[model samples]
Target: MATQLPVINLMGPTASGKTALACELYARGNYELISVDSALVYQDMDIGTAKPTKEEQQLYPHHLIDIITPLEVYSAAEFVTDATALIDQIHARGKTPILVGGTMLYFKALLEGLSDHLPSADIHVRADIEQQAAEQGWESVYAELQRVDPQAAIKFKPSDKQRIIRALEVYRLTGEPITQLQAKQVKNQPYSYAFQNYALLPDRAELHARIELRLQKMWKIGFLNEVEFLMEKYDLNDNLPAARSVGYRQALDFLQKSDRSLKNKAVMEEKSLFATRQLAKRQYTWLRSLQQTHQFNVYLSIEQAQEDLRNLYG
Candidate 1:
C-alpha cells in the first residue's frame, strides 16, 4: 500500500519566521515548501517583499514563487489548483508537502474549499469605479453600489475601495449582485490531505517592536527603490492589490513627496512603521478568526510547533 504523506502548514503574521521554520524542516528532508503567498508569486518583486534569496531557493526548491508577473493577477482558486497537483506529485515521490505562508485567505481557500463560482475581475468596470471614486469619493461609490447591491453595501464600508469596486464590477458583468451569486456557489473538494498547522506569534510588546524594526529594515533595504522599480517595471498603481501592501503605500507616499508636512525622513518612517503595525494587527485578527472558524490547531513558537509535531506524527 502506498503511504499517504501528510502536509504540514506553517502560518503566521509577517516577520513571524514562517520561512525560517519551513527552511529548517526542508533542510531535514521529507518536505517541499509550497508558497501560499499572493505577493511572492509575482516576479521582479524580490527584496522589498522579503522573498527568499536565490541561495535560499537553491537550498530547497520552492514552488509557486515567481510563477507569474506583477502584471498578471493571481488568485486563491488558481493557487489551490496548482498547489494540489504539486503536492500529489511530491507524495508520489515519497516526500511530504509543506505549505507555508502568511496569507490567511489563501490558506482558508486551500483547506475549507471556497465556492468554485468566484467572482472574476472586470478591469474596465473596476477602472470606471476607481475613476468615479477619485472624482466623487468613496461615499458616492458606495451609494452607486447600494443601488445595485444593498446587501453587499451593508457588508462593505465606504472606504473599502477594493471590495466596493469588485462589487460594482460583479454587478456590471452579471447584472446581479455578487453577494447573491456567491451565496449560490457550491462548495466542492478537489483533494484531501492531513494538515498540520501552526501560527507563530511573539509577545504583544515583542511583536510591536519587531514590526517597527522590520519596517525600518525594509526602508533601509531600498523599499522605496523597490516600489519605484515596480512602478517603472509594471503597470501598477495605487488601486492594485500590490500597491496597497504594507510599506509599499507609505513608500509611495514618501516617494511622491506627499508627506510635505513632515520635516524629516524619520517622521515618514514612523508613519510607515505605524501603518505596518496596524497591518500586522489586521493580519493577526484575520488569522485568529480563521482559527476560530475552521478549528485548525495553532502553535505560538517553533518549539511549541515541534512539540505538536512530535505528538501528531511521532
Candidate 2:
C-alpha cells in the first residue's frame, strides 16, 4: 500500500515565528508554501499584514497572498476552495504543501470542509446591512444580531463590523440563526493526505513583548504611511475588511481625524497593541480547540520541532 501524501499545517498566534519556521522548511526543498492568512490576501497590504517582502516571495513563493483587492471579501469557503486546489497542484508536482498562518477559521475550513448547504454571501444583503451600519452605527446592527443570534453576537465585539455584518446577513438571508446553521453543518473532511499539524505556543510575556516591539517597528517603518496610501487610493473606510485589520484600523482611525490634537500616537499604539493581544487570545482559544496537533514553544523548542519535521517527512 502506498503512503498518503503529507500536508504540513504550521499554526501560531501573531508574532509566534511561524513564518520564519515555514521559510526555513521551504529553503530545505520539497515544499511549496501556501499562506492561510486573511490579511495577506489583500494586495498592497504588506506592512500592516507583515507580508513576506517581494524579495522574500521571489526567493520562496507563497501562494494565495495578494490574491484579492482590499475592498473585496475573502471568506473561509473561498480559502478552502483555493487552498484545496493549491494542495492538489503541489502534491501533483511531488512537493509537500506547507500551509502556514494565524487564520484559524481558514485552517479549520480547509481541513474540515465547509457545509455545502450553507448559503453563499449575498452582495445585495451585505450592502443593505452596510448601509444600515453606516446610517445607524454598527452598534445598532450588533444589537439586531444579538436579538437574532445572541450566541454568535456574544462571540464578537459590537465594533467587529465585518463579523457582525456577516452574522446579520446570514440571519437576514436564511431566516435562521447563524450559530444554529453552523451547528447543523455536517463535518466534511476533504483531504486525502494526512496532516502533520504543529502550533507554536510561545510564553505569554515573551509573545506580548514581541507584539509590542513589532508594532513599534511597524510604526517606525512607515506602517501608517502604507495605511494612508491605501486610504487615499482605495477610499478605504472602517467598514472595509482591510481597514478593520488590527494595526491598520488604528492607523486609519488616527489618519481620519481632522483634529491632530485629538490624535494621540500613544493611544493609537496602545489600542493596536491591545487589539493584537486580544487577537492572540482568540488564537490561543482556537489552538486549544484543535485536536491531535503537536504543540511547541517556538522560542525554546524550534530546533526540536525542526528535527521532528525532518523525521516525519525526511
Candidate 3:
C-alpha cells in the first residue's frame, strides 16, 4: 500500500503569483509547502529567484528553501532524494505536501526517476570540452556531437553550446550514446490518497506584463548589488553555475563591462525584464508538458482555488 498522500502541485511561469495563491490555500488545508524550484534553494538569491520574503513565508512554514549554500550546486537528482524524504516526513505528520514551483525537471524527477539517458559529466572532460568550445567555435564542437548523437544534436540549436557540451560530455564520459537511455515510465499511479493541484495561468500578454513589472521590482530591490557582492566575494564570474542563472546573467553583464556604461538603470531594467520573460517562456513550455500527465488545474481566480482547498480539507 502506498503510504504517501497525493501531492498538489502549483506550477506556472515566473511572476504568476503562485506564492500568493499557495499562501491562501495553506490557510485552508492541512498542508506543507515543498518547493520544487531549482533556484530557490540558495540563500541571498531571494529576489532573483522570486522567493517569498520572510513575512510571506511566515504565513506558513516552508521546506527546502535555504537548504543549499550559495557556493554548492544542487541537481535534480539530489533534489528528488531530499524531497522524497521531506514528503514522507510531512505525510507522516498528517499534513499533505503541496509541491510548488516552475521547475519541471524537479517535478519530473520526483514523479519518475531521472532518465538514465545521459552519463554524468567528468569534470576534466567537461573542462576540456568547455575549452574546446571557447577556442574553436561551438559549431565545430556540435559537429563532433552530431557524428555521435545526431538525434540529440537535432534538438539543440548550434548556438546553445551549453547543452551541446553536455551531450558531447555524456558521450565522452560514458561510451554509451546519451540518447539511448531515455526510458518510458512503467506505471500509471492510482490516486489512493487525497491530492489536487492548481496553476495561476494568466494569458501570454498578462504574463509578459507581469514579468516586466517584476524585473522593475527586482531592480529596485537591489538585484544589481546582490550580483556585485557575489562577484566580489564569491569569485562568481560568468562561468559559475549560479552566474548562469536567469536574471544574474544580465546583472553580470552590467557588473563586468569596462566602460561601465550600461548601468543607466533603464538598460538593466530592460535586460532583466527581457531575460525574465525568456525564462518564463521556457518554464511555461515545461509546465504544459507536465500537465498532460499530472492532473493540475489552471485557476484564473484565487477565490476558486481557495474554495477548492477548503472543501478538500474539510
Candidate 4:
C-alpha cells in the first residue's frame, strides 16, 4: 500500500489570514498556491479583491488568479474542474497544492462534485429571471422558489439572489428541486489524495475589526477609482456578477448616484463594510457545515497557523 499525497485547503472568512498563511507556507518551498476565490478570477479587478501584489505573485506564483475577464462568468463547477486539474499538475511537479480563499461555494463544489443530472445554466432563462428580479423583487423570486421548491427555498434567504435564482432556474429547466438534484451528487473522495483542511476561525469582534480596517485601506488605495475604471472598461452594469461582488456592488451604487456627497460616500463605506461582515458570517456558516463532515486543523490566529504548518513542513 502506498501513502497518499495531501492536498491542503486553507479556508477562512473575508479578512482572515488564510492568504498570508498560504503565502508563508509557499515561501518555504515545495508548495504551489491555487486560489479558490470567485472574485480573484477576474483580470484587472485587483484592488477590491485584495489580490496579491504583482511582486508577491512573481515571488510566489498562484494559479487560477486573473484567468478570466470581468464580463465572463466563472461557476463553481468550472472551479472544481480547474482545481482538480491543477492538483494533478502540481503533484506531478513534486509540489503540494494549497487551495486558499473565502469562496465557500467553490470549496464545497470541489469537495463534493456537482450533480451531472442538473441542467447547465441557461443564459436566456437566467436573463429572464434577472429581468423578473429587476421588475419584481428578490422577495417575489424567493417566493417563487418557496412555492416551487420549498426545500431549497428554506436553505436560502431572499437576499441570496444568486442561489435563489439558480434554484428557480434548475426547477424551471428540469421540473425538479435543486435540493433533490444535489442529493444525488456523488461525493468526491479522492482515493489517491487526502484533503488536509485548515480553517482560520477568528472571534467575531476581531474579524469585524479586521474587515473594517481592510475596507478602510481599500478605500485609501483608490478602490473606488478601480471600480470606476472597471465599469468604464467592461461597460459593466449592476446585473453583472463582477459588479455585484461585495465592495464593487456598493461602490457601483455610490458612483451611479448623481451626488458624490461626503454623506453618500460615508453611506457607501458603511454598506460595503456591512456586506463584507455579512460575507464573513456566511463563511462561518459554511465552515460550521464543513465541520460536520470534514476535520480541520483550526486556528484562531495566524501565529497558530504558522506554528502548526511549521511543524508539518519542517
Candidate 5:
C-alpha cells in the first residue's frame, strides 16, 4: 500500500491569527497553501475581508484567493472539488497542502463530504424569504424557523439572517429540516489524505478586543471605499453572499444610511464588532464538534504549534 499523503488544516474564528500562522508554516516548510475562507474568494473585497496583501501573497503564495467576482456564488461543493484537486497536485509535487481559514463549513465539507439528499438552492424561494425579512424583521423569520425546525433554530441567532433564510428555504423546498437532512450519511469522500487538524482558539476577551481593533483598522484603511466601489461595480444587495459577510454587511448598511453622521459610524462599528463576536461564538461551536483535532491558543502557543508541525513533517 502506498503511504497516504498528509494534509494540514488550520482552522479558527475570525481574527484568530490563522493567516499569519499559515504564512509562517509556508515559509518554514515545503507547503502549498489553499485558503479555506469564503470571503477571500471574491475580488475587490480586500480591506473588509482582511485579505492578505500583495506583498504577503508574493512571499507566501496563497491559492484560492481572488478567484471570483463578488456577484458570483461559490458553494461548499465547489470548494471541496477545488481543494481536493489542489491537495492532489501538491502531493504529486512532494509538498504538503496547508488548508487554512476560519470557514468551518468548508472544512466540514472537505473532511466529511456533503450529503447528497439535499435540494439545490431555489432563488425564488430565497427571494420570498428575503422579502419577508425585509417587510417583517429577521426576528420574525427566525421565530418562524423556530416553529418549523426547532432543532435548527437552537443553533442560530435571531439576527443571523443568512442562515435563518437558508434554513427556512430548505424547509420550504424539501418540507424537511436541514439538520435532519445533514444527519444522513455522507455521499462520498473526495480526498484520500489523512488530515492533521488544528484549531486556534484564543481567549474570548482578547479575541473580542482583536476583532474590534481589526474593524477599526479596516475603517482607517478605506474599507468603506472598497465596499462602495463594489456596490458601484456590481449589482450587489444584502442578498449576495459577498455583501452578507460580517464586516461588509455592516459597512454597506452604514454607507446606505441617509444620516451619514458620526453617530452612524459609531453604531456601524459597534454592530460590526458584535457581529464578529457572534461569528466567533459560532466558530467555537463548530470547532468543539470537530473530532481528533489538536487545539491551541494562537496567541500563546504558536511556537509550540510550529515545533510540533516541524517535528511531525520533518
Candidate 6:
C-alpha cells in the first residue's frame, strides 16, 4: 500500500511570506494550496487582506479564498469542515495539501476539534450582551468574563471585544466555562492527518518593520477606497467581523471622521500600523504555543525557510 503524503502547514504572522512559499511549492507540481485566512474568505476585501493578485491566483490556485461576502460570517468550525473535506479530496487526487495563512484559530480548530456542546450564537443573547457592552463598556464585560471563566478570560484582553462577548455568551448558554468544554470535548476525537507544520517566527524588530511596510503598501494601493466601496455596497457595521478586521477598522474610522486633513490621515495611518503590529504579536503567541504542542519547523527568516523548503520540496 502506498503511504499517504503528509499535509503541509505553512503558517506565520501577517506579511511573513507564507503565501509566497506556498506558491513556490505549487509551482513544483502535485500540490494544492488551501488558504487558512479568515479575512481572505470574504470577497471584495482584496487590498486590505493582501489577497493574492488575480494573476498570481491564476497561476497558483488557492482554495477557500473569496468564498463568501463581507456580510456573511465564516466561523472556525465551518473552516474545519471545509478544510477537512478539501484535504481529503486533494489527497485522493494524489496531491499533497499545503494549508497556509495567518489565522491561528482556524488552524487550531482543524487540529483540535471544537466542543459540540458549545451553543450557537443566540440573537437575543448577543443583543443583550451588545447592549450591555454599549452601556457598561468592554472593560466591564471582560471583568464579568474573568469572574465567570478566568481560564478563557486570561487569553483575551479587554480590547478584544468580540472574543470577550463570545466567551460570555458561551457561559450564559451552557452554564459552563468555554475553556472546560473545549478541553473536555476536543480529546474525544483525534485528527486523522499526518501534519508536517512549519512556522515563520521572525524577530520582533524584523516583524514590526515588515508590518509597517505592508501597511504602507496597503495604503498606497487605496485600502481606504476599498473600505469606502464596501461600506457603500454592503450593510456593514462595527459588529461585523469583516468590518472589524485590522486595516479595515482603522480605514473605516478615518473615513467617518469629519475632518479629512493630512494630520488626521497620518494619525489614522499610525493607528492602523499599531493595530497590525498588535495582531502580529498575537499571531506569534499562537504560533509559539502550537510549536510547543506540535512538531514544527521554525524559521527565523523567510530566506532560511525558502532554502530549506526548496531543498526538501523543490
Question: Against the hidden reference, what TM-scores do the models get?
Answer: 0.89, 0.88, 0.88, 0.95, 0.89, 0.93
- After superposition, which runs of candidate 4 have C-alpha atoms over 4 Å from their true positions? none
What clash pairs does model 2 have? none
The lDDT per prediction is: 0.76, 0.84, 0.75, 0.89, 0.84, 0.87
Q: How does model 4 fare in lDDT? A: 0.89
Q: What would the per-residue lDDT of candidate 3 be over residues 176-232, giving only the tens digit for each residue?
A: 556775543333334344446577667788888778888778878888788887777
Highest lDDT against the true fold, candidate:
4
Over 127-157, each residue of candidate 6 has an lDDT whose tens digit, in order, gives 6888898899877888899999998888888
Lowest lDDT block of 10, candidate 1: 185-194
User: Model 1: residues >4 Å from true position, as ranges?
Assistant: 1-5, 188-190, 257-264, 310-314
- Indicate which candidate wins on TM-score: 4
RMSD of each: 2.7, 2.9, 2.7, 1.5, 2.7, 2.1
Q: Model 2 segments beyond 4 Å from truth?
A: 121-143, 150-163, 261-263, 292-303, 310-314
For candidate 6, report its TM-score: 0.93
Residue range 1-314, candidate 1, lDDT tens digits: 44445888778887777788778778776778898787898887776678998998999779999988766777777887898899889888888888988888788877777665556665566778888878988888899998999999999888777788878887888888889888875553545576667777766677787677777677677776787888888856766666666666666677666654546566777777787677678678878877775546666665777666655544
Q: Looking at candidate 3, what is the lDDT of residue 259?
A: 49
Model 5 steric clash total = 0
2 or 3, which is superior by lDDT? 2
Clashing pairs in 4: none
The stretch of ten residues in a row with the least summed lDDT in candidate 2 is: 292-301
> Who is ahead in TM-score, 5 or 6?
6
lDDT by residue (160-256, candidate 2, tens digit) is: 7678878888888889988888887757474587777888878889899989888888988999889888988899887676777888888887878
